[model samples]
Target: MQFREIIRQALYSLGANRLRSALTVMGVAVGVFSIIGVMTALEAVNKSVETGLTSLGANTFQIQKYPATVFGSGHRRNQYINRQDITYPQALVFRKTMEGKASTIGFMLSSQANQAKYADRTTNPDVVLTGGDENFSASNGYPIEKGRNLTTNDIRYATNAAVIGSELAATLFTQGENPLNHSIRVGGEVYRVSGIFAKKGAAFGQSQDNFLLIPITRYLNHVKESGSINITVEASSRKTYSRTLDHAVGSMRITRGLTIREPNDFEIRTNESLIDSFRDIERAISTGAFIISFMALLTAGVGIMNIMLVSVTERTKEIGIRKSIGAPQNSILRQFLLEALILSLAGGLIGAAAGTATGNLVALQFNLPPIFPLLWITISMAVCSAIGIGFGLFPAWKAANLNPVEALKGK
Candidate 1:
């Protein structure tokens, strides 16, 4: 028989049992949907994080009280207990000592989810606020869209200058009415807006464009009220990054009065380290999803096998009549196998489309753009084909090996 004839016969057989075929297809669809959706969403989110987090800069790293990628309990408490708050003098000492070795910078952060009000327009509490020096722009990568960057003179005298992000600027000021030179109340304290930052969109779940940047000296002297400080350092280049890190470690050790044998108390965070933390979390999630989807798929495969067996039983007499008349055993086998393949392929396609769409919907919650994974598509199709062949084999073999005498008696 022609391949077309085999396909035509298989399709006709499937059509005869429409409701049963549809139900089996639906079962497969549900199984495939669970896996493809989650994988796509995660991949898109990972890509978005890489792009948004690029601001951390090349060869640049930060030293803090805590590890960027922490995995266990008691970390927050240990951060305060085992670590020392980096002070202004320590930062200055590093600067004076490592002037040619590395570019040392100091900054302080005071974040409050306060309302930005201008004629009743309000913003969400996730607003970002940063306080830093003239070196902040070079160190943290804040690009100015309008007006000038904070000058050294601004920090030397503890200026009340502020740089507003694009989102915050639009929320407070009207079009053509520049926020520069205007006053914006932050935590009930008014400060002159000196510059505007370009749009930064979002990173993970955080909005990068809803921030206010001010001079660090003013922040420490006036805002903090505690007289404490946090210092940030940037390496000169990728080539000198390791040397810069060594210098900072030694310098912090000296400033903190740690002995040569004692372990370091400070933390240094790098971009690679942060990405590794993300990857570790991703690995855990992927493992769980794989186990769940695999079990569900195994159940669905069992369902397919049972349904195919029933289909062979229902068509036993018809199979014997065809075999006695010109249909070879291989032809009968091919016809039944192709029906199972059709059933699985149909289900898989529906599941893939639905899963891809659903994944993007979830990812959109974090402002990550939708992504379609071609590799995933290929893998899913191959899995569907394997399920069809694996489960459809016994049923097809039983039908092909039927006794013509018994089947003829039934007919």
Candidate 2:
């Protein structure tokens, strides 16, 4: 038989068993979906993290009582929890001691799930509330778009002045209405808006602009819980970042009263370190997804093998007649293999489309733009093709080697 005729016959055979073909395709689809969906979602998050998690601004790092993210035994976690909190007084002392060594020093404390109100419009209670100093904007990259940032007087006097994010300003102020000097209630305390922050997008499905900043002193005096402060230190230049870190570590240890024999009680975090932490987490999840998908694909390959073996058995007489009529063994093998390849490829395409759409839905919820993982799609298709060849080889070989007389006699 001609090669074209063999391919036509293989497709015709698969088409004849609609239910079996559909089920076989579904197995491959499920396998592909498992990995593709996970990878798509992680890719979106990775993109967001590149821009969002690195908000510590250039040449800046922070010292806080606890690590940003913790994973380990209960004892390890409890050690962090039991460490003495980085206090406001301690931050001030560190600032004073590191004055000439650093370009800028700032303190910040925050709370979540607080509502902000203007007139009758009330924002969701998911608003973030922060207390910081004059250098907060410079340290964190939250530039002021209108009015002015907090001053020394605001912190010294414990003034109720506030700087709001772009989203919060929009939520509280109408068109042509000035947000400056407007009184807004946050956490049940009224404060005059002093500045408006430039627009900052979302991070990890949370709004970065849904926040209000006040002077650190005012936050400590009224808004925030005690001992929840973090100190930010900025180096004068990129070349001095390591030097600044070393100095800050030494100063913070001294300020915290830690002896040489004791390990440092505080955690120092920079933009690069934060990004590294997230990458580690992403790698772990990606590894897990890959293992799960491999197993699923393995099962799907077995299913394809079983279905192809059954196909060969059902078409035994056909194969016998073709062999008797001068059909080559290679043609029989190629036909069965093509059928398996087509089945897996079709399922992969379907699964990739469905997984991409589903994963983008997760990104959409976080206000991130849609991403089409073309690379993943290509890789998935290639993997599926490999699976088809690996599992279908045995069945194709069995079909090609069948004895014409025995097959034709239904033995």
Candidate 3:
């Protein structure tokens, strides 16, 4: 028979047993869905991380009491917690010590889930209240859109001057009123607006422009006392970044009074390091997803084999009739195999569509753009084809080699 005729016959056979074909297809779909869904979500997160996680400027790094991300055992976590806080005093000393070594040194501290109010307008209790210096804008990638940044006088005198993020400004001054020089209450303390930060957009579904920055000194005194401070340092150029980082570590060690024999207690975080860490996590998640998908697909393959075997048995009389009418063994084998291929491919296509849609939903939650994992979809389809052929071979062989006399007798 022509290939087209064989294909037509195979499809008709599957259509005749719609319920069974659908069930088998669903099994394959489940396996493909698991891998594709996970990969799509992770790809979205990776895209966001590459763009949004660069909270620091070029050739810059930060020193903090805790690492940017924490993992591992309880003991490891406790080790970080047990280390002494990077006090404001230590920050001052480090800044003074590294004055000429780096281009700019900035300090910051923060509190979260704070409310902001202006006149009759009030914002949600999700604003980030940060304490920063004049260098805060440059170091942290937030530039002033209007008004002036916090000055030395503001930090030295602990003035109640604040710079508001774009989202927060819009929330409090919705009537197009000027936000600059206006007074707003944050966490019950009032501060005059000194500047407004440019719109920074959202990351990981969270608004980056929903924060308020005040002088670091003011934050320490009013928001929280005796807490760790984060110090940001920017190297003059990429060529000097390594040297600058080395000097920063030594200067911080001296400020923290760490002897040469003692290990550094604080953490140093760079944009590259942060991205690398995230990549490691992404790899781990991908590996786990692949393993689960492999197992699920394996089970689905077994199901396809069993179903094909049953199909051959039920169609024995029909096979006998076809063979008696001069049908060849290869033709019968091809027909059976084609049915399995169609079943597997149909399931793969359905799974791919569903998985892509589901993955995009996760991206939407984070305000990330949608992604189509083409490579994964192709791989899934290929795997399904393999499953179809590998599993369907035995049944096809059995049907092709059946004795025409016994099959006709319904044996």
Candidate 4:
């Protein structure tokens, strides 16, 4: 038979058993959906993370008590815990030491889940309260949109001054009402607004402009007294970044009183390092999704083989009649294989469409651009086609090899 005729016959056969064909197709769709959906969402999140990491100023790196991300056993957690806190005093000494060596140096301490209140208008308790100095804005890439940033005087005297984010400004002060010089209560302590930061939008589905910044001294005095301080430094130029990082490390070590024999007791986090950490996480998740998808596809392939075998058994007499009529064995084999391929391809198309749509929802949530993940979709369809051919081969072979007289005798 011609290839087109075989395809036409396969379609007719599948339509004859519509319910079974649909169930088999659904099995294949489920398998494809799992991998495609997971990969699509991960792609969107990866893009968002890359964009967010750029919020760090150019040629800037941060020194902190812990790594950007910690993922390990209890022993690893305790290792970070046992290290001494990067104290406020240490941060000050480090800043003084690196004063002329770097272009900008800033330190901050933060507490989360705090609310800000202003005359019957109050924000949700998800605001981040931070203690930072004048250089904080420059190092952290937050340009002051209105008024002025905190000054040396604010930090020196531990004054009740605050730099509010755009989101907080919108929530507390109505249109035509200025936020500067207004007294707002943050975590129960009143602070006069010193500046308003430009809108930075959201990252990872969380608003970046929902926090409030105060002077580091005021933060140390009013907020938690014992937390670690995070120090940020900007190299004067890209050419000097490496030397500056080396200098900063040496200076931080000297400030922390670490002997040359001991390993430095703090973490240095650069944008590259943060991106590398996220890449590690992304790789792990992708591997897991691939494994799951592999197993699911393997099971679906087995189901295809079983259903094709049953189909051959039910058509034994028809096969015998065709063989008696001098039909070629290749025609029978091709027809059965085409049926399986059609089912697999149909399911794959449905799954890819559904998965892409579902995954783009995550992009919307993170305010990121939509992702097509064409590579994954192509691989999925290819795998589905392979499954159809590999699993249908044996059944198709059995139907083509049947003895005409025995098949006619209902054997």
CA lDDT of every candidate: 0.79, 0.89, 0.90, 0.91
**Candidate 1, residues 304-383: lDDT per residue as tens digits?**
78888998888878988988897889998898888888888888888888889988886787787677877887888899
lDDT of 4 by residue, 1-411 (tens): 889899999999889889988988888888899899989999999888877887776699999999999999999999999999999888889988887899999888888999899999988999999989989999988999999999999989999989999999999999999999999998779999989999998877788899999988888888878899899999999999999999999999999998999998999999889889988998998898888888888888888888889899888998999999999999999999998898888889888998899999988999887899999999999999999999989999998999999999868
Which one wins by lDDT: 2 or 3? Answer: 3
- lDDT tens readout by residue for model 3, 72-160: 99999999999999988888889999988998888898889999999998888999999999998988788899999999999999999
Clashes of each: 0, 0, 0, 0
- Name every residue pair that clashes in candidate 4: none
Error of 1 at 145 (Å): 2.7
The lDDT, on a scale of 0 to 1, for candidate 4 is 0.91
> Candidate 2 regions off by >4 Å?
none
Taking all chains together, each candidate's TM-score versus the true structure is 0.88, 0.96, 0.97, 0.95
Stretches off by above 4 angstroms in model 3 are: none
Error of 1 at 325 (Å): 2.8
Q: Report the alpha-carbon TM-score of model 4 versus the true structure.
A: 0.95
lDDT of 2 by residue, 57-88 (tens): 67889999888789889999999999888888
- lDDT, residue 104, candidate 3: 88
Better of 2 and 3 by TM-score: 3
Task: Provide the lowest-lDDT 10-residue window in model 3.
Answer: 49-58
